[model samples]
Each structure stands twice: as C-alpha cells, then as structure tokens.
Target: MQIVILKDAAEVARYGADIFTTQLQRKAGAVLGLATGSTPVALYQELIRRNQAGEVSFKNATTFNLDEYLGLSGEHPQSYRYFMDQQLFDHVDIDKNNTHVPPGDAKNPITACQEYEAKIAAAGGIDIQLLGIGRNGHIGFNEPSSGLTSRTRVKTLTKATIDDNARFFAADEYQPHLSITMGIGTILDARKVVLLATGENKADAVKAMVEGPLTAACPASALQLHRDAVIVIDLAAASKLADIEFYQHIEAENQKLQAYLASL
Candidate 1:
C-alpha cells in the first residue's frame, strides 16, 4: 500500500492523471477498471485534458465500470454509463464499444453479472482499478458486511449509500435500492488499484482504510490484501490518519528515489 497526501484535490488529480498517462503509454490496450462519483471527476477531467493536448491517449483502452444502478438503463442520465460518457469517455478518443458498464436493466441480472465477470477475464483482467471510498468505507457498492471474498454480483444498497447518492437524483425521482457491483475479490484481482478520496467527510473512512484492521465492516479495508494498492488523498481527507506525518515522510523519500532512478 502506498499513501500519497496532497495539499489539495487538484494536486491529487494531477498525480493520479500522471499514473494513468504512464500506464496508457506503457500499454495502449490496457484494461481499466473505472469508478464513478464526485471524487474521481477531477481526475477524469485531467485525463481528458491530457488526451486533448496529445500528451496521452486512451484510444486502445478497454474500460469496465465498477457498478451500476440495478434498475437504470445505460441511457439514463444518472446511470454510471451515462456518467462515464459525460465525464470522460466522450472526451477521449476511445471507442465507445470498448467501454463496458454492468447491464443495469438486464432482464436476467444474475446472468448479466456472470457475463460481466467473464468479459473481464477474457480481457486479461483489469490492469488498474480506480476507486473512491464511501464515508462508510464501502467500495463499488459492496456495503458494510458484504463478504470480503465476494465476486461480481447483485448487492442491496445500505441506507448510508442511498442517502449519499440521493443528492444525484431529483426529489421526485426514485432511486434504485440495488446495484450490480464488482466485489472485493474481483477488485483484488486487478494488477493495480488507485483509490482517491477527498473532503473532510471522507476523513474517517480514509483513516480506517489505511490504518484500521482489515474487516468486512469497512469494505475498503479489503485493499490491504491487494498486492499493489495506491491511495491518494487531499489534506482534508487524510486528516484523521494517525500516521499522517510518517506517510508524508515516506512519500517525499519515494519521490526523491524515483527522481534519482529516472536520472540514472
């Protein structure tokens, strides 16, 4: 696990974007696991800017989204698919057909989830999975108490998740009570994971994810078992971590070492 504490959200986005650009350059056909929510919006925007500037390209990339509302169609404005298109996909040169999101409105959700997992396997698994920590430490709709080794499946949303997402919907609109999400086991399979968190609201969750014991009660803590997991947060989000100073010192030394290695 690597923790990067940035001065603010914009700095965090730049750092995250640099990682993506490097990955795309190293392997144009990389399979990317994507996440939705306000936390990743700035990172996506930075990627878009890099693509526009000819600094990076996602043209050959394949993307699988983390989750989708169980009852929403891909065309729905609030759906994860639509969110991807509006936020990142449409701006990049990537082929629309290469992007995949769970078929939220599939007639047979069980079969659809199975197919989603199969598709990811066929694509050689996710090269890098992007994530955002929920206030309650949930990841990809895998709410508290979700099985730690679960796979791609349908999951019921917790009240906390519903309340957090409510801001995205109109007061008159109905929000789905369920979702299809890639589970903790599936996320752990990614070759690399990059989790982003911001704002004071996420401070406690960030602390728990990086410092607390691994437990299903805080689903994000499952990342502790991953071989390669990178966590990036702004000052506000990292404020609650008890080892914040030590993490900062390590980051600074790592930066120096990386620069030195590159110079050689």
Candidate 2:
C-alpha cells in the first residue's frame, strides 16, 4: 500500500485526477471501475476540466460503477446511477453505451449480481478502480463482516451506513436498506486501485486503514494485501496516522530524487 497525504481536499482531488488521466492515457479504451460519493466529486470535476482542455479523452473508455442502492429507480436523485450521470458521465465524452451501473430494480438481484460480475470479466477486467471508504470501513456498501473473497451480491446496509447516507435523502425513510456491490475479491482483481478520503470525520477510519491491523472490521485495511493500491488522503484525514510526517518527508525526498535523476 502507498499513502499520499495532500494539504487539503482540492489537492487530493487533483492528485487523483492526475492518476486517473495518466492511467487512461496508458490504456485509452481501459475499463474503469468508478465510485460515487462526495469524496470523489472533486476528482470527477478535475477530469471534466481535463476533457475540456483535450488533455484527456474518455470517448472510448468503458466504466463500471461500484454499487447501487437496491429498490431505487435509476431516475431517483439519490441513486448511484443518477449521481454518476450528474457528476461524471454527462460532463465527459465517455460513450453512453460503454458505461454500466448494476440494475437496482432487477427482478432477481442475485442473478443480476452474477451477470454484473460476468460483464466485468467480458470487458477484459478493470484497469483501475477508484474507491471511497465508508465511515465504518465499508467499500461499495460491503459492510463489516463481508468476506474478502465474496463476489458481487446483495448486501444489507449496516445501521451506521444508513445513518451516514441519510443526508442524501429527504428523510431517513427514503434511504434504501439494501445495496448491490462488488466484492473485495472482485475489486482486488483490478490492475490498480486508488482509494480517496478527506476531512476530519474520516481521520479514524483513514488511520485504521493505513496503520491498523488487517482485519475484516476495517475492510479498507485489506488494501494492505493488494499489490498495487494507493490511498490518497488530505492532512486532516491522515491526522490520526502514526509517523505520518515521516511518510510525507519520504515522499518529498522521493520526488527530489526523481527530479535529480531526470536532471542527470
């Protein structure tokens, strides 16, 4: 696992965007695994800027979103489908036919999950996956206790996740109790992964993910086992991490070393 501590959320977003753009450039028609949430909003915005400047083009790229709230229609404002269209797909050149979000209202969600996983496989697998950690360490609504090797399936959201996501709806009653998400094992298959977090509210989770033990309780900690995963966080979110300054200083030194090597 690699950690990058930025000065603030905006910097973190730009860094994430740079990473995304570089990866897209390396593979123009790459399959991108996406996530929707406030944390990644700025990164999407930066991508939009790059698209407009012709620094990058996503016209040929394919996208597969991380999860969706079961029972919600795609038109629902709070649904992941709506969120992605509003924040990303609509703003970029990504082909509508190439983008996919799991069906929230499928007649048989279990079969839907299997098909979703199959589609990912058919796309040649994800080249890069972007993630955001829930307050309780859930990824793609795969709450605590989710087996690391689980596949795409229906999951019951924990009370904490429901409460945390309640802000998106008009009332608590509007929040869906169930969600469909990819399993950690599926996410781990990606060629690269980038997880982003910001704000003081995320401090504890970020610390646990970066420095705590590898336990299912902190699902994000599983990234420790991934060969190519990077965690990008703002200073406030990284505050609780031990030896954070040492990590930051080392990163600075590495940058200087790279620059010196280039000059040579």
- TM per model? 0.98, 0.96
Question: What lDDT would each prediction earn against the true structure?
Answer: 0.95, 0.91
Top lDDT: which candidate number? 1
Position 98, candidate 2: lDDT: 95
Q: What global local distance difference test value does model 1 have?
A: 0.95
lDDT of 2: 0.91
lDDT of 2 by residue, 1-264 (tens): 878999999999999999999988988998999999899999999999999899999988999999999999899999999999999999999898999999998999999999999999999999999999998888888898888888889999999998888888885457789999999888888889999999999999888888889888988888888999989999999999889989898778878997999899
Model 2: weakest 10-residue lDDT segment is 166-175
The digit string of per-residue lDDT tens for model 1 on 218-246 reads 99999999988999999999999997899
- What pairs collide in candidate 1? none
